[model samples]
Target: MNMGTRTDSRFMHLADIVKVNLELEQDWTGLAVHKSSPRGDGDCDGQKLLRPLLSGLPPKRLYIHPDDQIDMIKNLTGPGESETEWVLPLHQSENPTTISMLASLFDSLPNPPVPSRRKRIILASVHNDSTVVYYIVHDGLVKPRQN
Candidate 1:
């Protein structure tokens, strides 16, 4: 099998793991996550290949490289836009996503966040036992919730 196939399979597997967890543990009744096609150039997964969460939210780009060095720019949809363009990055569950990586992602965003709106990405890390944990990474510091 070629490298592209391997990456596709990995993404598909991750997506499946995520879906199962969402249904069984998270109580996501009608959740659906789609795996994107590979770019076919043997490049690491990024915005080019996305796995969107549900139907309303934008698809998240999958990144599995040990090093979080992304060169793609995130497309930020303007306010009032019906759909979110481009994609959000998702770190593989097993990978250690550092604060610097998160900062780079935020810096790569095409548009600045508007008041009352925050920019974030989903980091889906899968464990050795096939359990995946998803975290929402914000662009910058956010106010703690009172709950």
Candidate 2:
């Protein structure tokens, strides 16, 4: 893809995603992570895929609805209870890169309290140890009560 030119301002932040992924590759051996490419099929109805680093998190639902959260809280002490995990499944099954990032559990931060854009980065120091993820987001909206 053309990496040398002025890109639209709308996608400016995503471009940083690409840049960080490339720069951080030096810390990882096989995992090739990048932000969703412009040509990516994410806009497709059922074509959502991960961007590598995010795939390493438990999976169930990223954003738990308020009602669901209350239901879960009501049953917090019950057995066989439902649990929530975040699975950042990336698209590498058909891609050339063999590094397919599957589900991973993170030990940082509480689950989402509201639905909004999530910008995150999973990083490690070395030896597959000392790992941490940082999530930064920007959103301002007055959510209407659906209940």
Please, what is the TM-score per model? 0.47, 0.24
Best by lDDT: 1
RMSD after Cα superposition, model 2: 13.8
lDDT of 1 at 78: 26
**Global Cα lDDT for candidate 1:** 0.46
Q: List the pairs of residues colliding in candidate 1.
A: 52-59, 93-125, 93-126
Model 2, 1-147: lDDT tens per residue? 254233323133333343344347423222333233212222322222333222222222233435555676898832332232222322222232232332212213233333452323333211122232333221224232255
Task: Report backbone clashes per prediction.
Answer: 3, 6
Q: Residue by residue across 47-122, what tens digits does model 1's lDDT show?
A: 4333333222332422222221221223333223333322332445445456775565444444433454566555
Pairs of residues at least 3 apart in sequence or in different chains that clash in candidate 2: 50-89, 50-90, 56-104, 57-104, 58-86, 58-104
